[model samples]
Target: MLHIWGRISSINVKKVVWTAQELGLNFQRTDAGGLFGIVKTPEYVRLNPNSTVPVIEDDDFVLWESNVIVRYLCAKHSAGQMYPTDLRARFDAERWMDWQQTTLNPASRPGFWQLIRTPAEQRNAAVIAESNAAVESLMATLDRHLAQRTYMAGEHFSMADIPLACEVHRWFGLPQPRQSRPNLERWYAGIRARQASKGVLDLALS
Candidate 1:
């Protein structure tokens, strides 16, 4: 049996969880990272030196990094669908995954930390405001892309949707409604309708 270590609320963990559901792969998940505090243990560190929340052990194979997990799942299970058979199509999926890691994360983390993670009195108003503004602008780009297609890569929903979908959920769950990006809302609503989406990405904020 495959074993996974991560806290559900962590977006990276949610990516792997959602992928597993999409693949219909059965696995056991253990609570680690965040309040669970297992990542620092020598045992957990042996699997993932970075002490990341998501570490998967399958047979003798050990894999960490959320995006890599998503890719591996798609390749192993949804070969022609999520992973894509065409080289160009696969790169398209990979590109969006990288975009989420590079662009959306940096733009959204400050606001997420201040608004959701940090205590009210300890919040940085300036940083929160700036992050909010940055996310709004970044979301517009997503909105325009989504306006053209049902999913990030194209009409077919692929692994590309997984990482970006998690970020979009965070934006939607934020205090202020991002009314400026109606297309993004429409796209997110579609993903939220999926059973796997409900299972993995719909977790309550910590």
Candidate 2:
């Protein structure tokens, strides 16, 4: 059985959980990080020096980094299906995944931290406003891309959709102005329909 160490509320952790469920792999998830606090312990540190939620142990093989874990699982189990077999298709998926990490996550983090984690009294309105604007700008790019395709990489769902969907869910959960982006909304609706996203993506934002 695969063992996943992380709290369910973590967006990165949710990515792994959703992927494992999508692949129908039997997994045991142990709560760590945040209030759980096991991440600082030596045992957990040995697994991930970064002390982040979501470290996976597949038999004796230990893996950290959420996107890499998703890719490894998909390649190991679903290859030509979820992982994408064609060289171009595989890199397309990789491109979107990288975009999520480098572009979307940074633009959206401030708003999410201010609105969800920080108390309203202590929140910086300027930071929140700036972050929200950045996120919206990036979302516009996604909206345009999605206008032509059903999923991030192509028509069929693949590993590319998972991380980007998770990042979009974070942005959508913030209580900020959301301009109408029909294509982004349409793409999200499709993601919401997937059974594997039920306990992860469908939940209220933490």
Candidate 3:
């Protein structure tokens, strides 16, 4: 059986869990980060030197980095479909995945940390405001990009949707106010409706 290490509350872990469920793989996940605290152990460090919450071990293969795991799983099990076989299409998926990690996630994380993880008295209002503002701008970009397509990579639901959708789930879960971007909301609603997202998206942020 494939083995995964990460607590469900971690967004990165949720991406892997959802991807695994979408692929219909038989797997086991252990709570290993946040309050769970197994990530620093030497055993886990040997699996992911970065000490990240989400790591996967499958039949002697060890992988870390949440987005990469999503790509690897889809490429392995659902090639030419979830993974995208065309050169342009595959890289288009890659581009958005990179943007989610490099741009959107970073912008929204401060809001999530301040609003969800930190106690109200300790939270920084400025940080939350800046984070929300950045996300709103980025979301407008996404909303425009998604206006013509049903999914990130095109009409089909591909691995590209997984991490980005996870990102939207996190951003939207924040208690901060946001104006509805119809296209963005539509895209997120579609992914949330997936059976693969049942436990993942429904989870509350910590």
RMSD of each: 1.0, 0.7, 0.7
Superior candidate under lDDT, 2 versus 3: 2
lDDT of 2 by residue, 58-101 (tens): 99999999999999999999999999999999999999999898
Ranked by lDDT, top first: 2, 3, 1
Query: Which segments of model 1 are wrong by more than 4 Å?
Result: none
Q: Which regions in candidate 2 have their CA more than 4 angstroms from the true location?
A: none
Give one digit per residue, the lDDT tens place, for model 1 in 1-206: 77889988998999999999888889999999989998999988999999988999988999999999999989988998989999999999899999999999999999998989988999999998899889888888898989999999999999999999998888778776555678888888889999887767677676
Tens digits of per-residue lDDT for model 3, 81-147 = 9999999999999999999999999999888989988999999989988998999999999999999
The 10-residue segment with the lowest total lDDT in model 3: 168-177
Clashing pairs in 3: none
Looking at model 1, report the run of 10 residues with the lowest lDDT sum. 172-181
**Regarding lDDT, does 1 or 2 come out ahead?**
2
Clashing pairs in 2: none
- Residue 134 shift from truth in candidate 1, angstroms: 1.0
* lDDT to native, each model: 0.89, 0.93, 0.92
Clashing pairs counted in every model: 0, 0, 0
